[model samples]
Target: MPATPGAFLGGVVVSCAVVGAFEAGARPGGSAWPARARRTELCRARQRAGSGSAEPCNPFIEENELTDVGLGGLMKPLKRLLSALTGPIPVTRSRAIGVSERLSAVTTLTASLEYLNQRKQTQPGGLNHWPTARGVHGRSTPVTRKLLDIISEEKTTLTLHAARAVVSAGMLLPGSSRWRGAGNIFLGATTAALHPRHRYGTDGSDQVSILVQTATGLARFSARPQTQDALMWYVALQANASYFVSGWVKLMGKAWKDATALGGVMRTKTYGHQPIYELTQKYPRVAKYLTHGVLALECFFPVVYLAGGRLARPMIASAATFHLANGLVMGLGRFVTAFTSMHPMVAYTSAPRTHPSVAGRDDRVLQVGAVLLAGAASVAGVVAVQRRMRALEGWPHSRWLTTRHGNQLQYEMSEGDDESLPVLVFVTGLVSTSEHFGWITEKVARDSGYGVVTYARAGYAGSRRRSASSYHLAESVDDLVDLVRGVVPEGRTVVLVGHSLGGELARRAAVALGERLHSIIYLDSSHPGELNRSHQQSEATERIADGMNTLVRSLNVGLGILMAQPDWLEELPANCRTRVFAQYTDARFWAAGRREWAAVEEEFRAFDGKLPVVDSHALVISAQQTIDRDPEQLLMHNEIAEAHRGQGHSVEKVVLEGADHDSLLTGARFATEVGRRIIEFLDQAESHATSRVCVVEEVGQ
Candidate 1:
């Protein structure tokens, strides 16, 4: 549909009205809300909570925090005077562009100023120094690397900001129309730099500002009416996508559905408002209704185009109030202009094509098809790249075995130079891959001359369950038994090592392996009685369940790009890092995790605290945090060790310092230490066994 000039200008004016209201709400202290009173209340609340500090509760402020204030009182009268002076100004394409450009310019100017206020962070040894800043770029080409090096220099960055400030100032001038396009282009580049440099502090305002500036710059250069319409359509579509996608994603989260998301957010010191938090706590029902109201507005935001733009004003007004409220309560004041600036384009596009004043052919069919095609292409490209990255090399080569239950389990195995030594059969935890054991497995296989094997359980990684029915812990245990029996030679001794849920599987499998089992090592493993015994575990189970549910749904719908590469990537072998990350971002991995968790939660909830007592040497390696944070978990691990000791077996308990549950395996340092301890324990156990055999032989002679 063509963007009729009148419709475009009318939309821009309507957008200005919202901006006018936003300006009117500005106060002397730069917020419509009573900031002093809020702070006083926060201080009182903290004091009541037993904080005896003399000073008010002031945390470190971010760069965005410095510039999030509303328009000051000084500009209010001036804006009103200007409105009176230009009461009857005719709506035109140039005027609309001017208004949008100026709004975007103001946003960029304030952001650059805010960033400069925190300029120390851009210097060497600061949070945003080149070394730290460059990590977000991942693997870049040499040319791009050189460009990053140049732009990341403290002097260069500061100069760029200075230049951006000047460009923004020029954009604000009424007679800078000739240079508006170039100024916007420069501003877009500068705005784009802020995210990769200071990703932690920047918000939607920074992102929206970039989009506005770039689109406006491109629109300025395009003289064709059709091109202008297309640009406006692009902005409107993006605005709709931003809201709907956000709402839909949040809908997948259990917290949002249960209405606790807002309360949880407001309880944080970073973005919290004590009053609003208290209100949520005191009136949960009201909070629920309010949360759902937000979801309704966001999820159905595209309805603005319905009824030939009749609903546009009400929806835009609602959104304005929502942004304003967020500004007041969440201290995101700049969002008002950053987001609402796009409202003009939305309003313009919402106009009826059949209207007498408007000129357009309804080509929405082609637009929709084009959008779908682009989305599919993007998803396909992501899939192909991920597949390439996940390709593994040499040892731990992918292999599969079919189980009795018709499930196909994927495993990687390597027989180290020695065949006599008991194979170290590694079992991984739920939702985790065997690749996570890269560091420890390498250490054990190299130092101890023992064959190492790692396998993904059914429905995890390359493993697949034959049936879509409910998963059970017994089924996974059975699958492990099948994998071990299929891979290991008959009568070969096996040292079973398990982490978390894998430990439970190993324990059960030991009962089946009988005399073939040599030793058992549990690395911060799960206890059967955890859910029944510990209140904390039960609460965590609920949260984990909810999180898994959200993850499964989100990834299934191809939102895996939103997932970040975990910091633990460095813990694995260099060749395995990308493969592990690829697996993590794959939908099938999370789906398997969800299924496994459901079975685990169910089993744990019904657990009677019974576990098999294995008559073998046992080593219990517990992470320090596991013991420090949850004392019950320590007792449980000790209980596991004691059960083996009861069966006339030697047992050793060791705690690794500076390790957490996942980090015990995923942290290279901790994993190495774990491997060292395991080798030591194995040497002692074998030596003890050898001495006992010699004594028996001497007696027989």
Candidate 2:
């Protein structure tokens, strides 16, 4: 076998009739190309039927609305779907499916071989353990969990992988055309079914494999040549773009630019080779040249299309060699096969238009260019929508205030006719926006008629930090204080509600506010000493803090498009959900978060003394799941409550059942419960203060 067997095999396919078919528009297995006139007529009919129009989808009632109607409501749509699926498969589709199956067989074989080598990790309690490694998806519905469990068993997983391997092997053999489609179908299903079970120990290679398999599988069933061509082009473009983006991202990093990145990676235990690290150290100049060479190759990968595809062969060879070296040095063997599997498609797409076989073919390269342009335009449209969502004017009555220190903060203030009640001011956690407290803020303002104020901290949302100097924990507290003083009415006492790191800042602000503060509510707040007190917290801090800078760099290089939308964002009220999502996707938001994280990590690491407490009413609300995950955090909350009690103040501690730190604010059910508990605490505090005032008047008389 060749050192890069996948690429070599792919090259073989493109060198034969496959290339003639792929470039000249013919059916697989040497079938003659159909008449272009007929293809044009079919496309015109599709357009007339409104199937190819650019119009928006017709609005229809949601699925829930049909549930109570009867079986007819559901059966109507089901019948339409069945009719569509049973339609004739076009010759173009059949040809595409044949080509897709041949490529997918190789991908499936390489993937199964990689999984088989790591079979031990798929068992219970291993690194890639199922059910336990589901992460946040563990909270999925009972039916979903039951379905997941079916394929999560050790024997079932191993059997499916073996079956997929056998199918792929059979499909790759000579005279196996009769079983190719069915085998590809089976391999596709098995690959998807086993994905979630082995999230651990998987890398970019696994992601690339999944992407290629999925795109090809979809193209295999598409009825239109245009659709198949677009999907194939997407695969080829993605393969090239991945290399380009990765190179630029590395360029953004100081270590990569200075040629120290290779040495640093080799020194790590996870993806490292000690011998390579020692070699880099011994011959630094040679290492520098090698690193720069890699940067040039990756950054210029897309140049393969230049000079009528003259650069394609050598570029593909260099990339294969790079993956081969990575496999040998870093144990990333799957990367070699997974990435190489796309080279044939890349070669086919980038081949010169004037090639004899492609001379009379349709202008596929021009059509593909139009598709690329449309995609870029769509991205721009989404960004425009995001800007509209982020505009402060979109939020009614939202106002901006500039503090004395020159930092600008955006805040929303709501108050009913009532004037006697103390204003409720909310402070969100690090990297969080005021939208996090939307539920609680609305509930308090509407039900209790308490004036409510929620503001974004400096450099968050619409807020602006005054300078680009180093950030500190105290700077945020100062901003919070400035925001409070600027927004609140004169002579009105304030009730502070702080969540996460906001809780610690609120404590300091409460001391600063003196008599102007009435009560404090802490919502799953951070403790000053958590890094030292909890081993889990200490480990998590190191890992998260180390990655913050890299995350910012990734987002800055336009990789934010790949960031998955958070489930919490969906749970927020419909009015503010888009706004929050806009900020979440914005690279600037993450850059601000990274700056604050640096200060926060530093402060947590150097935490040495107890936090100061005030002689005021306080409520410490802990999430049950937070305590369950880290028991020591509960102890810290208790200490906070005790500290306020020691200062001769009224303090109550309550745990919100089934709520985690984020869910306390994001989950509607949990946030409603949290809101109710907070209202109850506020009422009790009001009554207590009233009783004290009565006693003081009586004593004066």
- The prediction achieving the highest lDDT against the true structure is 1
Clashing pairs in 1: none
Tens digits of per-residue lDDT for model 2 on 425-475?
899897787898988876777678689888888777778788565788788
Q: Which 10-residue window in model 2 sums to the lowest lDDT?
A: 692-701
Writing each residue's lDDT as its tens digit, candidate 1 over 1-701 gives 11123333333454466456433322323211223445556656877897876765652222124343465345656754543332111123444456667777766666676667777777677777778878877777888777777877778888888898788878877653446788888898877864676756678887888888888888788767666666667776888888898888788777888899999989988878899999999999999999998998899999887655556656776887887677667776557667877776665566555432234523464477598979886986687456534532213567888997899887778877777778889998988888889889989988887788888777666677895656788888888788878998776789999999989888878888878889889999988888888788887886787777777776666667767777778767897887787778776677778888888888888878767667777888888887788899988988888778643466788878789998888888889888988888777777664423110000000
In model 2, residue pairs whose N, Cα or C atoms come closer than 3 Å (at least 3 residues apart or on different chains), thus clashing, are none
Cα lDDT, all candidates: 0.73, 0.70
Window of ten residues with lowest summed lDDT in model 1: 692-701
Compute each candidate's TM-score over C-alphas: 0.73, 0.68
